[model samples]
Target: MSKHFWQTVGLGTIAGFRSMTAPALLTGNLAKFHPQALAGSPLRYLQKPLVATGFKLLAGGELVGDKLPQTPNRIAPPVLLGRLLSGALVGATLYKINHGKTLNGALLGSAVAGLATFGSFWLRKKTTDESGLPSALVGGLEDILVLSSGLALSKGTDIGAPAGRAL
Candidate 1:
């Protein structure tokens, strides 16, 4: 797979943690730095400032909602589906900007999201159950990680690589 494939995986992983966050960061970055990447494509709407702001609001709400007691499991069918779609959008948009096949990006993004959904859920559950830490606190920490990583990945920063290297 190409570097874009790995990028989709990174974005999808963030979607698994917070369904709207990947798109939030992705759209914001696109709107600010790659407006022309989606020219002539339906996805270009995502580059609009309003659309990016909307996504950011939704992502913030999701982060807060995740800490609520009534929040459903991330693996729930409806919730999981949303996360998958979020990842798909992130992947497709990245691919479009990078001159890759959108469908391929969507597939990789959604697949990683599905896996990360369960993986993050299990990891969070185990840590909470074992360490006696509050789920809300753990989730807050996750929110930090998601935001930091999402920003970097969306900005084409390669993980584990030299500072100047990017995808």
Candidate 2:
């Protein structure tokens, strides 16, 4: 309906491909470069009180629910988690930013997410593929997009003119 709407769509499409990195770039960049644009999005969750505690748990390598099996274990769980994280987070982010009212935020977040995926995929090709870094990075980025976009959209403003139309 609007130019911003189209932009959001583009972002959502990209975000579908890869979730984590897109949001990370946006969030991290905003935090460092565009503080003015920073709002109540999920990106701000990084600084929350409970989140700080959760971070410590993650940093400590502690698994939630159940302890992870050592070696000779199925890789399905981790793989599934990664994929789910990517999709769900990205979707949620889009929804959040949209403020549960529009597809605008989701679309924008998706586009951003897609860019991150493309870049990460490209980089993985150059790596030794020995480490699981690629997948992990993808997952994390997806989470960021989903959370940030969703939150941002929750209170977003429709700005600018529609596409393919004269101002």
Candidate 3:
């Protein structure tokens, strides 16, 4: 497999946690760099402004709503389904950028999303319990992490490198 493949997987792993934000970041990138590719699709009408504004709003809403008491678990059926779809979309887009098969990306994205749903839930619970911080504070930090990850993936940064590897 190519470095791009690993990079895609890394981004998909992040997407498994961020779900909607990752895809929204991809949508923004597509709108900026390849507007014509979106043509004839349902999202074609979004254009740059709508794509940027709308997805950001949605992402913000998700972040805020997550801090609410009534917000559903990330692994809930409907929420998980949405996360899987978002991951697949973002992964497929990343694969297409590298001239790879979309199906492989979709499968990778969906699998990562499923795994991350459980993994992040456990990690978050553990962190909150250990740190003695409010869940909201931890969720805010997660929001920052997710947003940063999404942006890095969209920009195609050196995700292929291991932690200490030079880009």
Candidate 4:
């Protein structure tokens, strides 16, 4: 489970940079090796229209302005990918926590999410000279906010309790 979470984080981070490549790589890898993991719980929710769209875009190679239509820049793809990856990691972490009767699983989950989001955001900042320092700092801070918020909402106030159970 830990290995899978880390792999997903790495893939999601890569996807964050080139929204099209990461999902295609992830879907293919999951379909090939981690097929069972994709079948249940929060991971199953990925069988949705938005994920399909992302898969299509990724498969179609829209990342490098190759073999795709010219569309204005937007943040939708990366954001959606981030959410999906985060949810999957959180779900898997919760499952392990419940199955093992553990209390620290959610914290681990949040750390993984933070690592992935910050890794991606940092990579983007370091690689792109177009965006100024202010944009990068603000964006990195936003990623941290999102990760913290998601962790709170999914893990709730107590780790031993069920996720969002108190809500």
Candidate 5:
């Protein structure tokens, strides 16, 4: 459908790999492109400052905690739910700001995030089993991918755009 719809879906897919990072990226986007959307919300007073700060901290913590031996699987019930919810919220916000169907966006986002979660988990396990590299290194790479993708999707920039046209 619309470019905004695709962008929201892309963000949701990224969120499946890194749940906390997606919301942080969305908060940044809301501050830059849709500040008015937050005006009447409960968080209006805290606004971007608090939202961005809190999510960023959470994202960073997630990345670090992910390397810990006691860390839970991303696909575990609690973690999966968080990722799904984050994807839905970000997708709805993006669609609402772009004047699209919020419910459709949320559904698309949640579905994609769930699929991505399973896909990434399988891929990560396969890679670790085959390559013999430390899981941490592979996970770090995934973190980078998720963060970059989140930023690009949230900014609504064409990833293949010419240098001058890229965000």
Candidate 6:
């Protein structure tokens, strides 16, 4: 698979853990490094610094919320849908920027996001139970994983790959 494919998959995986994170990181990347990548495209807004900032703020909230006792389950229908959309958005953005089909990217991203949601949830639960770690601590660890991975995947678009040209 191409690096972009893996990057999209990684972003989808990040969405599974934290819904806003992948989009946030993607938007931030576009805003800072590839302003013309989405020119004349509906996804152009993603390149706006304001949009990137907004997503970043939302990502921050998600990070904190994930550790809260009152936060809802990530697999809940509504929340799950949000994660799916988040994955789709970033995937589409990356694919479009890379001259790939947006729908294909969306489908790949959504599918992985769904699978990762359940898989990660189970793993988080198991880790907490087996190690006697607080759920919050485990969630904090997940935040680290998602952020590091998301950032890398987002920046990976620049591996000498041409950004999507007004697609």
Best by TM-score: 6
Write the residue-wise lDDT of candidate 4 on 6-104 in tens digits.
433444443333344444443333333332333454555433555646675653544344212353222446554454454344434344423432224
In lDDT terms, how accurate is model 5? 0.73
Residues 70-127, model 6: lDDT tens digits: 8888888998999999888877877777877989889988888888999999999999
TM-score of each: 0.88, 0.30, 0.79, 0.37, 0.84, 0.90
Mind giving the per-residue lDDT tens digits that candidate 3 earns over 1-167? Answer: 77656656666666667666765666665565553433454444434667667877887788888899898888889888877877677666555555567688778877887788788888888999999999999988988888776676657643312223221
All-Cα superposition RMSD per candidate: 4.1, 10.4, 5.5, 11.8, 4.9, 2.4
Would you list the rank order by lDDT, best first?
6, 1, 5, 3, 4, 2
Which regions in candidate 2 have their CA more than 4 angstroms from the true location? 1-19, 29-43, 46-75, 101-167
lDDT of each: 0.81, 0.39, 0.68, 0.42, 0.73, 0.82
Error of 2 at 134 (Å): 16
Instruction: Please identify which of the two predictions, 3 or 4, would achieve the higher lDDT against the true structure.
Output: 3
Q: Which candidate, 1 or 5, has the higher TM-score?
A: 1
Candidate 1 backbone collisions, by pair = none
TM-score quality measure for candidate 5: 0.84
Q: What is the lDDT of candidate 2?
A: 0.39
lDDT of 2 by residue, 1-167 (tens): 54445444444443443333333323332233222222455544533445445533542342221123341111235533443344344344434433443343544444444554455445543442655455445445544554566446422433212223322
lDDT, residue 74, model 4: 29
Candidate 1: list runs displaced more than 4 Å.
Answer: 35-37, 155-167
Q: Which candidate, 2 or 6, has the higher TM-score?
A: 6
The segments of candidate 6 whose C-alpha lies over 4 angstroms from its true place after superposition are 35-37, 155-167
